[model samples]
Target: MAVTGISANRLELLSIADAVAREKNIDREIVIDAIEEAIQKGAKSRYGAHHDIRAKIDHKTGELSLTRHTTIVADDWEPEDELEEFNDSAMVRLRDALKRDPEAEIGKEYIEVLPPFEFGRVQTQMARQVVTGKVREAERANQYEEFKDRVGEIVNGTVKRVEYGNTIVDLGRGEGIMRRDQSIPREVFNVGDRVRTYIYDVRPEAKGPQVMLSRAHPGFMAKLFSQEVPEVYDGVIEIRAAARDAGSRAKMAVLSNDSSIDPVGACVGMRGSRVQAVVAELQGEKIDIIPWVDDEPTFIVNALAPAEVSKVVLDEDADRVEVVVPDDQLSLAIGRRGQNVRLASQLTGWQIDIITEAQDSERRQKEFAERTGLFQEALDVDETIAQLLVTEGFATVEDLAYVEAYEVAEIEGFDEDTAEELQTRAREFLERQATELDNKRKALGVEDGVLEIEGVTPQMAVALGEGGVKTIEDLADLATDEIRGGHEIRGGERVKLAGVLESFNLSQEAAELLILRARVAAGWIDASELPQPEPEPEPEFEDVEGEDAFAREYDDAEGEVEAVEPEGDTDEPQDA
Candidate 1:
């Protein structure tokens, strides 16, 4: 950087390059090249600006050389830039060069050694700027290359500065910023304080590569457990899933491959030392380390700790679960501000709906009463017979009408004669309902072709007619969501939109099938070309041994399962 005086000795120039290379952590050759360019620019300022000046330095002896080059060009050769005129000082015509030397040809260079001149104030300033810019660019490239591949790693750095709630950390070789939202709430750091963070993202930008850091990411918690729990780091136990509410609380599910070792007990070391280490680093944020199970219901039960679950009903198609807990355990199951259930949902990737036992009981009774009344009206049966039919899971007249006479006769107190009579009445009721629906469909101007499409029943035709889809083409043009209810963002708020066939409780797949059938009927697609439904994957079976095998045997014999007590308080995390 101190190469201002061209009169300085050649040894001093090389010494400056060596010192700069060492200070900036760059190669000596790079620094020497930058200095040579700086000297060339200074030489051009003293010599004629249009002259072709070049400078070089001896790698070993530190000697400097300045030269002016003139190249012989053909008479037809023109300048490359359209706006620029020829430079007579840098190039010579081959016709004139032949007059001076018989061997002169195009592209032949004539070099003349020049004496070095002292650097002026203006020239020294310009040369210094050029060298400084080049060095800074090199430093940025070096920093980016050193840290780009270190993403998803935990790093230690000193707090260099804080600006507007963002912490700038000096990583010794690079700098990283932890935004306000990424840092633990209420956790403050002073300058020069050592801090540990996890790198979640690293990407190149116009200014330079950015190293994004965070302490609140779910990966941060998982990484902390891997550091403290040797089983997790060694792959003996695996962290299956993790969810965090930042400084409030976090939950992670872990499983063990070796049946002899308990994952929860291993993570929660003697007297809670291992978990406490992570808790302390996280500013006393509570952690729940649930033992992960392959069964989703069992895992959800484990995730909502310190609260007992009475029953669990899952809807696999919707990826939703309805959990029923005792009246007294409702608040505990929901947690403070729904944090427990929310974290459980995140950890399990399911939408959970929690309900009390009282509510579930009331719902069951209402459904039973509704179905009993329907059977009584449709089959012309007494209240007792209708209630018995409801208890036997007879939901609709269509189901009873199509069932085998033997199945109906199997019901207690119902003989062959009673079964025959009930079946006759169910068929009559269905015929009447179909006539009414068909009349309504006709009144709505629904084409007969719409009902001709496979899977489009009379009820669906009525619904589609009311929804303004009166023809097969109209039905074929509709999206599946338009028939299977969904939410949409409107005016910055999520608004619920009712589907045309939402009352039928159609699944997404069923809705798609209906539309595909309509499209085929409309001549929009060939029936043979329709996409087939993929087969469900077979469930994996693992060989069980040790406690797992014992538990399964016990469950089979006793008709119930015993929950394993993780060796820690239910409120704290015991595993990774």
Candidate 2:
């Protein structure tokens, strides 16, 4: 056995590993891992050994051992340990240098380690290599164990260096890397910056454990909010949603079940204290907290705070929204070249088209006329009666979905031929609309949460977009008529919305209403568009005046048809 450096008595593999652990303040297992790694490296460096080799270290006590195992079947002349050539007895003390115990069975193999002896210069160099390798392996193992479970959790680390906007953090066990992409843009970082970052992941790489960290992760912002606002952690205030622009701005929607505890106020704290602290963490990022709403239009109003929405045109079939503000408030509504609307879109997941009142009004009058179901051609009595027939539920746009088109035809106001025409048109229009939607779906690459189904007029798309329904996927289930109907119900004396529904392929408003309506019908939404009905009609002459009484009643009963009926028809009050 040849040796270099200090001698280790009874230095089993485990003992050396333990000593390294105690000395380096690393785990003992790390040292064992290091030693085993080193042994394999050393055995490989030998290059000519035909025997199996192994290395191990004890856990409870520091001990290190290495051995070369030789198969008894063909115990060839190749030396089992590091040295390949067998030397004479003087050059190789086989019995003593190799600890050979008396388990003397010929066919059984033996594993032995080199005993204490002098190593030549080359051999000493080899010894240093093994120890260095073991140390490096220990460092990696230690680093891995320390940071593995910390992924996705916040960690405090000092900025060791910054290069090309990328900050390298020195987490005590090993270095953590924070790349430029992970950092909030325009936020300056310098050496010794005590930053709190979220550990996104830990991956094992060639040199050591790779610690991936991020400052812009939403979780980081959420955690900061939790720390700054005591109510957040206690569940008094809940963060329902957050939309970020990295270093520039963030919009969060919050809700508090406790009516007395205002979510926004709780976040803002006294004199803007709590929110300020969170802002400081984000390096002065602007944050807007808006209250969440059960209704989308109302929610959007809050989402785009500080701007008054004069009108919201929902494109139900397209799941988009068009919002109109007065001309004077356009910039405020858009917010610094549309930053507000942009973030609002991200927050609400919708495409919004904003217009001034004039533009909105003009669009409604001209381009969106189809939405009203009417046109330049004047409507006469027959058309009105025809519409009334439709309102009574004989509309067969999608005939398979309804019963009794014929019964509707038999009603006092309608004839069979007209009913048949109505049914056919209804069916064909539905078929056309279906084909249109299918085509739109294909063209838009319509995927859930991504592309929207087509058929939205620009104005309607804007309205629904403003309302938070952004895609055809958003509109397909909706009753396309509801949005353009503008919360108005169809059945009434002059309430015939025929011109509106039939005139514009456009609804009275815009495509956004149709888009959202479609989605509503498809059951993608939980909202309802049915209007509250008007008061019921009352029966005539419930109260009788006493003057003429039954004497007039007897005369009326006898000559009722000729005298009373004609006069009653002329005198009776009726809807104009």
Candidate 3:
């Protein structure tokens, strides 16, 4: 198995390729290709470069063969001028090819076996480098293919290196990285320590496959629970949603397919054995297992466990929930640093506002007073009648005027006749108010363009006219927040131009809709243009450098203010 005049053994070449393939976890064929390419390079160095030379190795016998190949051209294949342009290295005349092979025909190839050449130290070193480079490239391709489909699965690896708070893990077949922010709070790893992480992402880069692993990800806990709980793994129970404040606490919602088996109880295991195993792996992060309910309010109540909810008012249009807890349970519902409600919000996919029963009652009282005053002033009704209307949840004159007679009659202390009379008074009062506002709007020189816009009531038009927003274009120029809450100026003074629509008690959502319609009317935006919700920015954890290395991973107040309708009638109108 040795080549003449060469110090390296041919059999040893195959052995080396096998060893490298095993160590690098690449295919043996890839290593063989590298070896053949390196041999071809060495042979080319010995022979002339102009000759077409190739090398092949026997898969089992480890025998190497080197040969030169030339294309056979027919003697009468082309005109004399065309033949003259053909290069000698690429083609041989049929008559000349027949000397080597009497049976040579047109389009056939002439092969000449060449004796193996001796390799010098420099040439051998160069060949080794070529083989190494090719094998390294093959290794990278193998690594990328192996882990690409494994994203979102948990992988166990040993810490191979740590640089600048980033840990590189040797996963046996591939390497992964856990970035500083992706690691759990206050968690640390030294070289050779076993680490378990979630394969969050896998990206192909110039260097190699970048396997992004995470310990802080919510999916990581889900995977851990799947491993510990056989019910979860077997699909008897499904994890509907999960939220984690890594190393601090987590919440998971599970649903059971079998009615007899409780999802929460299955996840909790017998006497907390299963969840405890997951907790130990997560460094003692507290977990709350909740049964998943189809009803949103019930699901939300389950998410905010251990906190008794007195009432839940859902604003479905805005994807928000106003939760009222018993006065003593308010602090528990909110949790320390607002963690409980924040996790519940994340799990439920709804923004939540937690208030005590006392606070809710007070708010309701204030709303009742505001509506009572509006009815008293608008319909010239007494305080008793106004209070009765407010108690029945008639928040606007429009609601009373347009509601079914039976709906109003169902109110206490009101018959069908009284309901009809109240509706008449409500409609008449609204008509007179609209006429007065129209007169004021005309006197203020409000343009017809502003008046024609939908959502701009006559009263709103007068307010806009007073604020110098006399045209649709002027109204369209305002920002969404500006229309919702007028911005404050220097020295605590506020600009009132944007407050024109706010005076009508429009929700932020309604105000934005009004401005959008105005923009459409002014030809600034098309009617087909729809508003898209902005993506929430990822929270940045503050790195606290100390013995603990504590990282604060959650924000105190994470909920965004959504557009909520006014709870009472619009405030009493000012003199036009």
Candidate 4:
């Protein structure tokens, strides 16, 4: 039967298609595809046809209709693999194309068209379900496409629902997923609560494009600053650098090209309104907006917030810094868990060693006295003599100890024995110092360095540079192919970069420490990078424990005082 009562349904479909297009922000074709797909599924259920069918609408007439397509074939042609074969002259070009593929024949009937029947109880119910589900899905996909490119952008969304610590944000376009990891710690949300988030990631997957929104991203800070300070948006105040421990604290360094505007004051706002708004959004996450300075000392001072720095000594060649603080503020400068100076070190891009005023003063005084010799009371002759001997060409204790008596007689006023005495004293000092240095190395937990070898490539060097595989975790992370080349130690010739070992040229022990430190830094292993120590040589079975007097070994044949063995019925060794 030809269906005629579809004009109202056609109008309804058009209305739905338009409304859904507006809802999902997509064009009308997507909705039409969804509708056609739903109709096909409905037709399958309605007719119980041999194969699936399709439906379409008259584009010009605005009339709803259906069409079914199936393979036309004659009764004689054979399709080798199938139980049915419809290859004959009556069939169209099916047999002609099939000659290229013997598995299919021209006359094979793939499907047969069927007339449209009135949609009844079961078909109408099924058609409505399929249409509704597909339309909603298409809408979600449209929303995904609409928002995917806007990753890293800021948007306000209302909390629509929460499940498993994930908040579904209704952005009016669609629901954006704010996962547990994306949320600021301790911040809570309820239905209809509007919150701002940074669109961080958008993953197009099977169900839909997953919209990943975050409140803890670094861009969130930038966005908030942009919102608060007009200068940032207008390009007057430049945010030179920003570092964040999300949910805890954030430190940002800003520079002002416009001298008329104070960057810090602008960001802080009058009476602290601007920064306060950000703080409220972060649930009281502290923010420090500091003025960036070019001079390292000045920069370091600003980097260490809430604590005053007295001095900063930068060692560019060594990439290290010494931060001097007043004795009273030493503890405060380091902060709880060393957070203050640690963050300052990161911001300043140097390895920072903090020294209090007392330590710095003592060091300066000692160096001054050594250089001037103005004060003799505090100057030990041993240190002075050590310096003198070093300057006089007796460089090391080993060299001094091996010097002949004849050579010791060369220096004026110093006889052979006196020189010998000097050598003895120098030797003793070096020995004690060597022992102390060993203890220090042990205390520091020395590590290994990289080695240079043939066939080393840049890729291998980068791999070693990034990870020092002293531990099992590092090894576990490597792919099978990477492990094939074997691993390099941090201080080895090929692996350790050139400049890192320069400081150790005058002091080779320093190089050892550097390699070990690099290994530790790479997390290749704990301080002890080696595997468990090899089992100590098993101690020989000694006669000390439970030693039977008669069983004690002795030179009996030589007539020495030796215990004689009673060999008869005692627990005698098995006969070999």
Candidate 5:
């Protein structure tokens, strides 16, 4: 009866391992390894903690073996940690092992088989904990591997539970959490409810792999469209960009490779059937599917549909676009709380400023009057002459001072002597202005070294001094945004922070260059470390005809082409 019981227990151990592996969806070998470790720990607790106990189970015979290993070591061998005392039970000195075996050597391990014994309550508990911990670790690892690459894919799951407005989803193989912010506004779920979500991220944590799910992600809309539109799935159409305002509104820009198939129409389906399905899934969030184009200005115009745009001026340096709409369309273009413009900006990756035609016209008139006054005051020219200069695109006294005399003389009603007189007056006025600015800068306690940096003008030096930057070191310490202007969140609202050189309208690259030069002047960096300008490629000449010839030749010589002179000069001051 004793022999039969022992055999039955050994078979039962293997059967338990198989059941656990099957239930955990892990490999049988892993469960077997975990069991071996558990048995080894139990043996160590029973035989004495100092003994090197090991356990193994036969794969086919369902047989268990336990042993105590004594490793032979040289006399000089010591414990790895200085504070740890030598473990004499598990280790034998080489000299001591030679007494029992003549051919004893270092690293020779002698093993003594241990008889199987019944487990006590404490031992059974420890074994269970060890097996459970190892199996849990394996399950977590398996879950991570299964879901890591599934990011950006829409998945179906059942709602496992809701904690503090976060939904825990059961994805069969793993669990995913959809935080409140990631779900559609006002969307609620109960336990066991089927839910569809997008897997945006999978992060491994100590507790387990965190499967992050979302219904409001821009990618969620895109994936839904792909599922509904056959052309999008088969690569006939591509969704280039998508943006969402959760339950309120969304926008998607798509492109069609096949000209016969309209990308927007295909996504909309027959009589809006396809889009309706998506809207249902998103809890009635309005979606606008616009056809994407390579031309950024045209694409932005399409993005702001139902609102007529009069003009769009893109400032590529700042990644910003100023859109002018009809006065009546202002509310529509900006949408409720600026939603329309905001979504368009996100889709196009540009900061958008929307204004009515009246606003734009007013701003233009203000600029023209300012420029005309500047010329009139600086060059001692009459109002008519200043208006003429402003209409002719002479923005400042500096433009007339450095321009070719012939170019100025070529203006209607202006002769060579008149151009010469204007040019002389401009140069003299600029000299006086520079002297005044230099005096102002010095009065503000601006160090003379600040003016030594390349690209720093006397006016800029004065501006810097007024902004509390008086020395090269002070300028070097400023970030590009501090010098170029940016938006900052202050008191829970975004406020525009004026830059020191905001009036100068410096480009981002120009601001960085100024800081870099200041750093070099302050001895913070070697001058040689400054970036070198890339050599311009030689211009390829092609045969040009008619009006383009002169402009092309001038552009090739000057490395920049001047703006075309407006047709029919008028006293009303044509727009520049």
Candidate 6:
């Protein structure tokens, strides 16, 4: 067949499709599909547009065919189903179709061969454009599918162009975009520079697939190490966690599967060759390779290596840790602008606070003295008794009041009578303190609604009122964190909303419950409207006999229908 000024050759068409597919790095089938679609469009222009025209290509020979398709239907058929639309060009009566095929049936398609058209210059140009557009679209879809699963993988590409601080990388088969923020700090790139980046995201858009590349991502450093270290790549040395300060510094926690292999030594290589390679790729980003430990305190000590830890105190409830180091190591442990502790926190998933041994010792002495003084004043006990109580882990008057008589008596140099007296004094002191706080709450104009919440004591209510949260609605408006920690204002000034609640020492769960109660009281939520679990579905009767028996048994069961009916429906079914 010949187009107006164009000739169709099966071998030449196949060659062109193979070349295009190779150049686009797409499947040859996609190129053939594009060609078929382009030919179908051209056929529609040459023939009637209203005809149900279709086109296909012979995969092996690349021979193209254009045809008109008509659906065979009953002679008296009326379009009822959504698929059976009335169209003269799409359907043929059964009788008419049977003339061509005596065994023709309704819903079977009839294909009529059409003569291939000769294409004009304008038509050829249009077909070429259509094929090119389809190929480009297919290329994008292929790119998306290829890179979507590769997210979090490290990719190597050459810098193609830099536009407004955004680097466009030629990934050989596709392009990737590295936004300025995703690049390492102060890192510079030029055209044709070899770049290694993490494929952080692949977004499919109308224009094309957006392949997001990043160098500052922690995963990039992990991948770099994986590439440099055989043990890491082989999963013998597993990177437990990584935290990066971009081009400045990074910390990684690694664990070894084989007890014989040292994770840190494997990552560092001989004379730091392995780690140095990763650092060079990151533009000299200093990386600290620490061995991962299951014990958090020991792990933190490892993370803060080179700084000898004098003591480590963990506040498990708050997920925070305090590291006390030697006076000389304090600066090193904290790092410049607290980077060391910050990275350690990130790696360990805990909040870390560092202090000198001297400072920690001073704080401890102060706390002991304060507890001794509190017991002395509240329990009317002497220094010795107060010291004993403090040493026994009684930090507050409330602790002494709430302890069992036997527990108090178990302390050294204390009997049952002494325990009872101490308990009485503790309770009396607390009652007096509560009375004073209640008077203050009233004086502060704290509403009764605010005082009624479970976690809000009289002192907390007064604090809330002082902080401008005088109503139940005000307390309800506060977030759980706000009630627990309050917020810091400008110039480091903290607005203490629930700071007074610290005396009560409520747990996070208690504080949240208190906030929920306040919300309920403020009519923000219904207390009884908690989410209920969905009931399990009834078992299906698998056998036909069982199913039929169930149906009959259910039908004979009296009041079964009435029991399942909606409440308050009085209408009954008439006798059928």
Q: List all candidate RMSDs to the true structure.
A: 6.4, 18.5, 12.7, 23.0, 6.5, 17.7
TM-score order, best first, reads: 5, 1, 6, 3, 2, 4
Model 1 stretches astray by more than 4 angstroms:
1-21, 26-138, 446-457, 471-493, 504-532, 538-576
Best by lDDT: 5
Q: What is the lDDT of residue 175 in candidate 4?
A: 71
Candidate 5 residue lDDT tens string, 1-576? 011223556787778889999999998888888888888888888889999999888877778888999999998986789788768999999988999999999999999998878777777788889989999999999999999999999999999999999999999998999999999999999999999999999999999999999999999999998899999999999999998999999988888999899877888888889999999999999998887766566677778876766667766666787788899999999999999899989999989888898998999899889988998888888989899888887777888899999999999999999999999999999899889999999999999999999999998999999999998999999998889789999999999998999888888888999999999999999999888999999987665343212221132321332222122321110000
Which 10 successive residues of model 6 have the least lDDT summed? 557-566
Instruction: Give lDDT per model, in order.
Output: 0.85, 0.61, 0.81, 0.63, 0.85, 0.80
Positional deviation of 288 in candidate 1, in angstroms?
Answer: 1.9
Best by TM-score: 5
Q: Cα lDDT of model 2 overall?
A: 0.61
Cα-based TM-score, every candidate: 0.76, 0.57, 0.68, 0.55, 0.86, 0.73
Local distance difference test, candidate 3: 0.81
Error of 5 at 571 (Å): 38
Compared with the true structure, what per-residue lDDT tens digits does model 4 show for residues 434-536?
A: 6665454334333222222222222333334444443323433444324332244666654533331222231233333434444455575576763344688
Candidate 6 TM-score, C-alpha based: 0.73
Put down candidate 6 lDDT per residue, 1-576, tens digits, no spaces.
135322356777788889999988888988888877777777877776678898888999767777899898789988788786667887889988878888899999978988767776656777898889989999999989989999989989999999999999999779999999999878899999998889999999999999999999999999988899999999999999999888888889888999999787888888888888888888988888777766565677778765666556666656777777889998888888888888888899988888897897899799999999999999887999999998887878888898889999999899999999999999999999999888888888788878887667777888787777889998888776666666657677766554535555566866777777888998989987533447999986554231101111121211111111112322111100
Q: Write the per-residue lDDT of candidate 3 for residues 179-227, one digit (tens) a residue.
A: 9999988898999999999999999998988999999999999999899
lDDT-based ranking: 5, 1, 3, 6, 4, 2
Residue 503 lDDT in candidate 1? 91
lDDT: the better of candidates 4 and 5: 5
RMSD of 4: 23.0
Candidate 1 lDDT, tens digit per residue, 475-505?
Answer: 9998988998899999999999888988987
lDDT of 2 at 433: 61
* Residue 333 alpha-carbon offset, candidate 4, angstroms: 2.0
